[model samples]
Target chain A: MWDGRLLRVDAREQAMINEEHRPEIGESFPVHAYYSDNQKVRIHSRIHYHSYYELVLVCHGNCDLMVHYELNAMVAGDMAVLPDKSIHSSFCPPGEDTQVLVVQFMPDFVYNGTLDTVDSRYMAAFFNSLRMKRHALFQTGEDLAMLQDLIWKLLREYQEKRMGYTVYLRAYIGMIIAYLIRRLFRNEEELINYLRDYHRIEEAVSFIEKNHREAITLAMAANQANLTYNYFSTIFHKITGHTFTEYLNLIRVREFERIMLGGGNSVSEAATAAGFDNISNFNRVYRNLRKSSPTQVIQGLRVAKS
Target chain B: MWDGRLLRVDAREQAMINEEHRPEIGESFPVHAYYSDNQKVRIHSRIHYHSYYELVLVCHGNCDLMVHYELNAMVAGDMAVLPDKSIHSSFCPPGEDTQVLVVQFMPDFVYNGTLDTVDSRYMAAFFNSLRMKRHALFQTGEDLAMLQDLIWKLLREYQEKRMGYTVYLRAYIGMIIAYLIRRLFRNEEELINYLRDYHRIEEAVSFIEKNHREAITLAMAANQANLTYNYFSTIFHKITGHTFTEYLNLIRVREFERIMLGGGNSVSEAATAAGFDNISNFNRVYRNLRKSSPTQVIQGLRVAKS
Candidate 1:
């Protein structure tokens, strides 16, 4: 099991095995907490990614978390920070009975769209995990135990949904993030680098989001960060694991679906409104990003609504 | 000692007795944490106020905190939430050896200028304290003890000035605020009312901050809140404990001082830049609000710098 053979999966095959998981989160709160065990692990054994940060703390038994070419073995009191959209999977041997607490939250849940330096600094650990291509893992220790206790309280608060639960949840998550930053990044230089990269990509991401409907291009995004087209493209891919065009199309497809699901728009109308000039191109990009035809997803949405 | 006579101080006398205390806080990280005991309390015994929220947790002995016409007798494990600029004083009888943990922070330190609903909701207890003319006091209990642990940790973090102390300090404070909201306001309606009032006043305050250099009026502020001039004035005074004109002039005086301290500007130049049209009128308002003439304060500033 210690052999490094499992780390040699081909890029194309890894992409084929990866799945996107969108955890259910309240729009206003944007945080979800739950527990995962071996049985749950088997059910979701495929490499998976989501568009929000996930923090996992092991409670019992042992498991291995794979992020790209690296594997981290985790045990009781061990914790892992999985940045958003990082392809990874978890595994536990038979009879291990591994249990882990999981917390998933959007960046907005913590910072709430404020561009303040300190606010973005809380996200340093998450961004570092993505940039390094290795999940941030904390082994069994006193600090990890303290954080585990907080995570348990967070899960309880989420389960109970008591009065002012959202406020409490946000506070708990903020504390956890702070703990991660204080532990993971030892010096000021590491944090500063992470913060700088976050802002650069964040600027490009924000620009794309604001003007995705206006036929924006990669060069325009690069200009937003004052970087050359080639360097910006390379950094964007390294950080996000997606080419700039791929990320842009993913956003456009998501917006298209949102417009359609809001009930009054036709497929072609949404396609155009979401920045696609041609239906064929829109359908192809939607399928590539979502692994489903646009029509099928729309039908599923309608069926679920009905 | 519990007699109601102490609660009958006249408003004019209270104003004369109340002093403005500006706690030193770093601009980037606007939080200051310290411990206060009877000796320190006596030094600051006169009723005083500051333009920042302060949380006080009693660690030992007994003290009485007088806010406006009300008094709260606080003992060990008691905590008090004092809103910004709320005239209040603490008294500990001789030999009590009272000690308390004090955490003062600007509202921006937590919410960071986000107008998000939940961000404002974290401030409910503070606003409620100001509106009700009574400080929010949490008595000894299990929950308070838990919060006390966080506060102690916060004070340690503040003292240590570690690598990411600001992030940790902010997290601890956020948790404390969440605990306050969860414990103090048992229901949603109270929180909703407090949140509404915060937003209303916050809107007018933001307007004054942004347009103070121009000619603005109480009527315009009322229009911002969509309330009549008389009603807005009443609510503003009830919430802030200062008449509309008093608060406006106080803001102007603060702006004027800020300009002068930045250097190179004559007193008249700074006063005009801060929206004061006449030097005499500026001096009168400055002396009334700050209890010091403009020239005197400016000279004091220069002397201190030298």
Candidate 2:
């Protein structure tokens, strides 16, 4: 009689041995899809975020993607953009063979700009294009072709990979994003406004990403946004759903988790590298938010894998 | 008084504008680089390809990086990956306060499937403790720290970028490949095999990325290795070179060129998807022997950026 769950008993401690699950670091290796019998299966998996952004191409099937509780049904040829820190998950309809190519990254992937000022308009257009309630993921016929080419190129690379495939893979990624923007925003007024707003938010986001290392104050972030502290603070919470400080810390935690999961450094190193000036403070926050200590989490993952 | 080739034009037609450089059907982005300076002072600017792969990271400095090699080079840590066949031209190097991150990817970037077959020994050791031949390329410890973190996280996500970050910037192209293999390979014997034979030669390379398209010629490739047309051509190649047919495409053209300068359905698709079917007859053999074209060379790359 075998059920999915398995438990080990520890006699000495007289307790059931707890299992540790080191969630796969999505930021480290985010693309996860299984294709069987012509169907692609991807578990809902854990929710997460990163310094870089993400773009998803739904090649086939139907599913509901829960981005902060806004459930949207996704089908073939649809694409979506998940901005930084937007909690999200995706689930395919029963028996639906879903195949999705997910591209996730951060500002560094494009340019190494601080969060205060990232002027890559191509990226802005990409983020803005997703703002549309419903739009063709590939606007131009050429764009669709380019996207298909990229997927095939990726598959081929993954299949028969040569040296430096990564270099070209990144280039394909850039081409897809550039094509998406060009196809959707051709000298339109909405495009202009989209760029403007995107820049504003981008500047704010950059501020958070770069300054998250130091003791970034609300006033500093507000100033970067060119708004009064009160106005910016209230609006920031609304848009990002966390106070500026909270948002900054969350960003750090996400990054910290990414590095730590690779099992390269000690917990303290992860904390320090992720921009925690105070270990005690970091630990307290980690416990409060994650409901566990960093060590416990790491140890738990190792045990589970064993 | 310092006229050291400030700008170089590699465009096939001097009059051909930037927008006109769009790729033909199935081609990936062209490869080129540029150089420039601010205030019309004086500076040297250049961009080109070397080795098998290329890497760019912003260490320090500021300039705008136009969509098409147009005007500026943004701040430090703004990185880009250029495969062979890509054409990128830069404006100028950053000011005195600039820091840059640049690494040229060798053909190994995608060829060996070192990252794919984790059971191999060399791959295991490399991943367990990743190191570059030149430490200077690593820059400051901080830079290495950030770069490595960025690299591995980027590799982890190469299979899936749900957001658009990987699309445009194509950053983290290097680290993802490195980490993928490092995390998976466990057997010592497999690791040794990877280091010794995986990196060099054609057949070994080919077997690594073997399965690209159904059109590939199994018989011809088998003969190329001097094996009976059907005596486990793939398995024989692996015994000698540690490879397979699914692996051969990586060494030849299917995986290598497909993503490099836009291998889409264009020349590479024909080469990898079609060329493998007739190894002796295809241009890959000629190119392998002569170091020249199965496809048109990325046209218009001048030795100097004007």
Candidate 3:
């Protein structure tokens, strides 16, 4: 019953991607349409991960986010990408309302040949690497802006219907992934910088996973790594692209998924076991992070596993 | 693209659903799954509501299907209760094929809930309706056997769950919609009464949609319906409960969404002009049936008038 229990529970638990959530999966012709559902909550989800990749763009206002465990004060123009199975969560923070353009997709959206058959050696190399494949966090303002534009363009093409937009979408997905790899792994220093503290960060993550039921904090994680608070916070973000709080929450979401699948099929059972003291917060956070509600997730899990 | 192009696109498209292609409006979920190279096809869709409601039970299938468009289909025993607009889609269909337990919920799934939250009223109404809902077409001996077993226990607790039963599964779904409804709606006139002249069925459906697209089908539909030799040979199965192909695709898949704050967008211009060949299908079917495939429908069309 962690906050993302509604959305993440089903998606995370089943590991199905967005394509499966669409009506046009195998249809030959594409259609564009508008959607407005005032009855539907605008934000639903919790910090979680599925096997498919995720990209989120904030179209309006600012948000306080934890991406791949990094705590970030994100603005309208900011964006982030979480790779397959990487734990991540995001929200507008307390009392702060924001509009987010959520983009959930599978790696096939890029890797599919509908994009460009021309495989860039750089992209091939980047995808081939374990570290680069693990996760991605975009900090560059320009890249974010460009990504936003490309997304807009893709949406426009999808809506407008050009000659070969499907191919374009595949290419755009690839371009975005390629761009992320280029930004993250542009130099040896970047890779080295990310790896040096990765061991400690991972250790911190495992510790959180192993002991999330108890009270834990940045200091605790820092002490486990034998580092100072300020240094550890910076190093944690640098290495894992998330802060300790974000990481802890991701771990909790992961645990929530585990419990939901194994036992604790009910809301109360799953939430408490996931470590959320207040079910409402669990609901709200789950909605914001996973883009679905807990009732939905539990229901989804039951249906999926059934 | 084939005439069924409109049915093919997904969330990545930009054009409005109404304008793209309207040939495939009322196609139900659980379409045949096939692989192209390595990419798997997945379809997410809402609950089925043709002229009537339906219920389906999936028994021994190792497939992955999304229930009501949110839950996952992980194994054999899952069941689901899908309200209209609640989505569903094909999951990993079992490898060597599998058995299914399907039920169609009638108008009763809703009315039963309303007549009073009174459990007895719902039960009585559900049981009474089951006779009419039970299909005699499940001619296979094994299907009849499984259907009988499902009918007994499933009816006892269609509204409530047994201990440790997963609520959001297809089996559960079949229980509520198929078996319970069958037991309730059972009527003498319902079994083995009608045999149609199958020689002209497709032509009949085509004539109905093209001429009476503006009007709803009545007893007139069954009176003159016929099927060609080839169609009569296989068409009945397609129109059977598990799958229902329409005379005209009734809805447009909303592949993309856009929010317009200002004027200057054209709905009709966005529709037929966008790329759809059958403008009338886009207009009548999209608005009345699919509700939102046209670009203008998606943009809210106020911009178009402006």
Give the alpha carbon lDDT tens digit for every residue of B195-250 in model 3. 13222344455554444323434335444453344544354343322212233232
Selected candidate, larger DockQ, 1 vs 2: 1
lDDT, candidate 3, equals 0.44
Per-residue lDDT tens digits for candidate 1, residues B133-155, read 44577785766667668888999
* Model 2 CA RMSD to the hidden true structure, in angstroms: 21.7
Residue A107 CA displacement from its true place in model 2, Å: 4.7
Candidate 1 local lDDT, A1-306, one digit each (tens): 422222222222333334555546644557889887776554135456666778888888778887754677788888888766566777788666888888988766675433555545556545554444445777748776677788889999889876677767877887787777777667778767656666678789779878989889999999999999998897788666678888778668767766776774588989999899899999888777555677776666455334
Per-candidate interface DockQ score = 0.26, 0.07, 0.01
Q: What is the TM-score of chain A, computed separately for every candidate?
A: 0.56, 0.47, 0.47
Model 2 C-alpha lDDT per residue in residues B182-227, reported as the tens digit of each score: 3333444555554543333246225434434555465655655555
Q: For each candidate, give the TM-score of chain B.
A: 0.56, 0.29, 0.29
List per-prediction Cα lDDT, in the order shown: 0.70, 0.46, 0.44
Off by over 4 Å in 2: A1-52, A114-119, A124-145, A183-185, A188-306, B1-306
**Which scores better on TM-score, 2 or 3?**
2
Q: Please give the distance, in angstroms, between residue A62's alpha carbon in candidate 3 and its true position after superposition.
A: 1.8
